[model samples]
Target: MTSHAATPTDAEAIPNLNTRNVALDRVRTFLTLVVLLHHAVIPYTYFGQTDAKSWIGFDAIILATDSFFMAMFFFLSGLFVWPSLADKEAEKFLRDRLLRLALPFALAALTVIPIAYFAIALRRSPGTTFAVFWWKTITVGPWPSGPVWFAWVLLAFDLTASVLYRVSPNLVDPINRLSLRGCGRPTDFFIFLLVMTAMLYIPMRIYFGPGRWFEFGPFSVQASRVLLYPAYFMIGVGVGAANLHRGLLSMDGRLAKNSWVWAVAALAPYCLLWALIFVKRGMLENPVWLPAWYEASYGFFFSAFSAATLFAILGYFLRFKRSGRSMLDRMQAEAYGMFLVHYPIVLWLQYWLFDFEMPAIAKATVVFVLTVVSSWAVTGILRKIPGAARVL
Candidate 1:
């Protein structure tokens, strides 16, 4: 969700490129809503349910969202990176990224994350004071970054892209060429993405397992998909390197026309993933350490599903939402800020509803609606502070 705003100089350097892509803006805002929905329903899923009521439907929803949303976030974040780098001095680019990404990540890790996680701590020990819990979290151990981990990781990727840009501006030229070809044949790009992600994700998943995360203080990342994310980011950089309008995301492109095909492609691998999950749970007895073969198979389907879903979602937006001001357009300016602040609202709502007797679906619906409205309102208010709009 990096800003797509371009300077006058950028318009000169990249001719025919619009300052903003309404479709992609809508896509990013939609993803923010997806993130909200993911968190809201997770507590009702069979795997993560902490409530008295659990629903299998929520398990399906979690499965789909968990598979691709964050990786797609990285891809969307990367789409504007190369252009930004090319348009500004290296120092200026890095400075802007630090202010936009790193600063928000730091503030959220220190304040937002602790407040959100305090709900969990309170569940464990009702008498735990916020000050004591916050101190223990920061000083002692296990300071979870929660969802804001994306911000810091994106900062790292942006910094890396800057260094790579300095080394060779043409480093991603091959990807740019591929993107041009993908204008008419998006399957090629999808195939390349699937292969790249599989190579990066499958082996690491086998080695580290799906649940293993590399954590240090408030900085944590899923070990299995660390390389996978950067791969997507770099691909995004390549696509936006040059001739962005005439490439894979072109409004007149086949990618938009064949959106349904990509949707089918996404569905196939997603179902395969569920089959593997069933085999692991029912046949393999859900072992603590899944076999390498299971992990490999699962990893392949996961990668395929993720890549195909990225295309499906992007294609749908490009095809049907290329113009006009929708609700997503209205939310675009506030999406990133909402993402940063929603965790606390979601966690607190879940905690408060823990004692309620409502059905799982009803409770999840309430949480999702309230989190969206509350987070959007909070972000709007925060943006009103002087100099806050620059960061938020």
Candidate 2:
């Protein structure tokens, strides 16, 4: 919550920044944190069971986070790209992106990920076998359990965005010129996204099936996590097209000026989210009332509500600057690396904590915090290590 330093003193010095990227980054952090919460606390539906849980009451809640994170991350990528495309030559941009994103992915896959499996094993009472886990980690490539796969998806998105930038020289001008003029209102934007995405993804699920393709060897399931997750990424593009940021910020800036009112309004969206989850959990105990329509509604509401709530909350925070600018700078500086490394630590922590008889939610919360803090701590410690600081 604490910010360390200001990003920039004046808007003029920074070129072409609209309210959208600001809103999206804040929203991205929140969704990512929520995702950490979901992963840290998977449903009792499967881990040790023989069959998958059909109801997906608990699983459904997490599903929302997965797609939401995807949508928001890609959106942010696109939003940020407007500048990159406009600013950099295509070859230079692609070179930096590949060096920074893809290379790290390969390195993380080879190094950081192996560290994760070993970390989890060492944390074990008997431990993960050195020979078994080492070979598995290396020969098998990245798995779902680690966060490394995200790096791959990120590379994909970056490559896609860079290509879009290239094509933009010819095609984007006719379309993108509108951003110079400005975009439509936020409400109109939200409804547009909701309708468009529902029209887009729902039928795909109905026809193509939800199971993943373009897999990593036997880990076919990970294909969805890598590629299929981009619906949110496209949604990110949609939010940009809608010009939702400035309007939301204009509204949020006003409300944030009145802290009490803004805080209360911020809580409103969450009340419905929690209520829906609570009711769904209890109802699923009995199958008689289940309906196919309800499943669709779940996805619809989850997608819609998450997008709206994220922007609203982000608009609220960024509208008002807290004094702790340095904290924000430090956290933001560290957050990228933190995200890169956190999940594997969380996975290891799961191995340690999985047997505990705690509530699903509570256990997840604990692991999430531990992983986040540990990632921060690790990054900080690594920052001090000889030569490691440069790569980090």
lDDT of 2 by residue, 240-339 (tens): 4333444333334342344344335435444555555566667665343445554455445545655554454544565544333434444554555666
* Candidate 1 local Cα displacement, residue 229, angstroms: 0.5
Clashes of 2: 13
Model 2: lowest-lDDT 10 consecutive positions? 1-10
lDDT of each: 0.84, 0.50
| Candidate 1 lDDT by residue in tens digits, 12-100 | 12323555667887888898898888888888877784888889998898889888887788877777778778788988887787788
Best by TM-score: 1
Give the clashing pairs for model 1: none
Number of the top candidate by lDDT?
1
